[model samples]
Target: MSEAERVPVEVAVGVLVERDAAGREGRFLLTSRPPDKVYAGYWEYPGGKVEAGETVEQALARELREELGIEIGPAHPWQTLVMDYPHARVRLNFCKVFDWTGDFQMLEGQQMAWADLPVQVKPVLPGTIPVLQWFAAERGHSGPTHLD
Candidate 1:
């Protein structure tokens, strides 16, 4: 086995969701990758790596605050998936965040969109595809989840 395969980068992902008064999950947040970063322009959930001594939730909060300029509320633990990319193997920890304070801001010079099934965004990130499927299953949605 190759040496690089042994260590996976741990990332904390925030699936920020909005719920209606009836409490049904509504629109979720998607952010375009920064132009200077990998997979630039591809849309994905917002979050970043879990630094040393930081928990997934901590990382999620920090990343969201730094990247979006919002203070997130309780983050419900969701799914965890490990994806193999050519550049690095990443363990993505996805958390569903339903409440937050402050207005949205693209602090990283990225675009943010709120969308539901048949997600209107184009060029979804590879790691984000499974998340779409997860959402589909939970929402009982059929058909394509997003554009290629």
Candidate 2:
């Protein structure tokens, strides 16, 4: 199908789980995509596609458990964005999670990091770049401004 006729594959949800650091800016989680996945090695907030009959929160919880081995608590809906990649168009629903259980583990052999703004990870997924900018703005930092 042509680009105009193509439908987005699915709506995906992600969680930014924060770690409050005393006397320092708090950090949020970012995960590297598995080598086998499209956009492999790119960093993004942990989440997965919302399945049939599942709410975004449900998907976030499930994905975190399966991918990171953590059970999420008190996830607050934050922002939503629609992006079109070469592989598929997607709607990303990002949530800010303030609480959770279990030690964070990379169950999928993916790298994990707790990052502050201006993340050190190289090559973040294009769709996630905007989220990072939004995060910076929310933290009272100046994000990029575009001139059209």
Candidate 3:
């Protein structure tokens, strides 16, 4: 099927950002793709696809719990992007998550990191680059967002 006719997979992505006492956004979370998945070792926000009957918020909450072992609070809808990758086309629905309870477990055998602008992680996933750029824009950050 042609690109126009192909339906993009709807994914719910959680941008888990830390906030200070004054409510200023700070470092967000990133997770390395599990070893067996496509683009493995590339860092990206924590999330997964929206299931057949789930809304973006439901999917985000469920995915984060399963992937990171944390029960998220409200997932404030942030941004959406359509990305066409070699493996699949996806519509990423990013939500700014500020409140959550529980320690992260990295349930899928992936590594997780809390990162800020000019992210210290390497080999970021292509699907994740735009989210970093969005964070940079919102924070008035200038420079390469992450290492290749």
Q: Where does candidate 2 have its weakest 10-residue lDDT segment?
A: 139-148
Model 3, span 1-148: residue lDDT tens: 8877779999999999999999999989999999999999989998999999999999999999999999999999999999988889999999999999999999999999999878888889888899888888988888988886
Q: Write the per-residue lDDT of candidate 1 for residues 67-140, one digit (tens) a residue.
A: 99999998898999988887788999999999999999999999999999989988999999999999999999
Estimate candidate 3's alpha-carbon lDDT, on a 0 to 1 scale. Answer: 0.93
**What's model 2's TM-score?**
0.87
Query: What global local distance difference test value does model 2 have?
Result: 0.78
What are the models' TM-scores? 0.96, 0.87, 0.97
Residue-level lDDT of model 2, residues 37-141, one tens digit each, is 998998888888989998888888999999989898866888888788888878888888888889888999899887776788877888778877777776787
> How many backbone collisions does model 3 have?
0
- Winning candidate number (TM-score): 3
Query: Clashing pairs in model 2?
Result: none
Looking at model 1, the pairs that clash are none
Considering TM-score, which of the candidate structures 1 and 2 is the better prediction for this target?
Answer: 1
lDDT of each: 0.93, 0.78, 0.93
**How well does candidate 3 match the true structure in TM-score terms?**
0.97
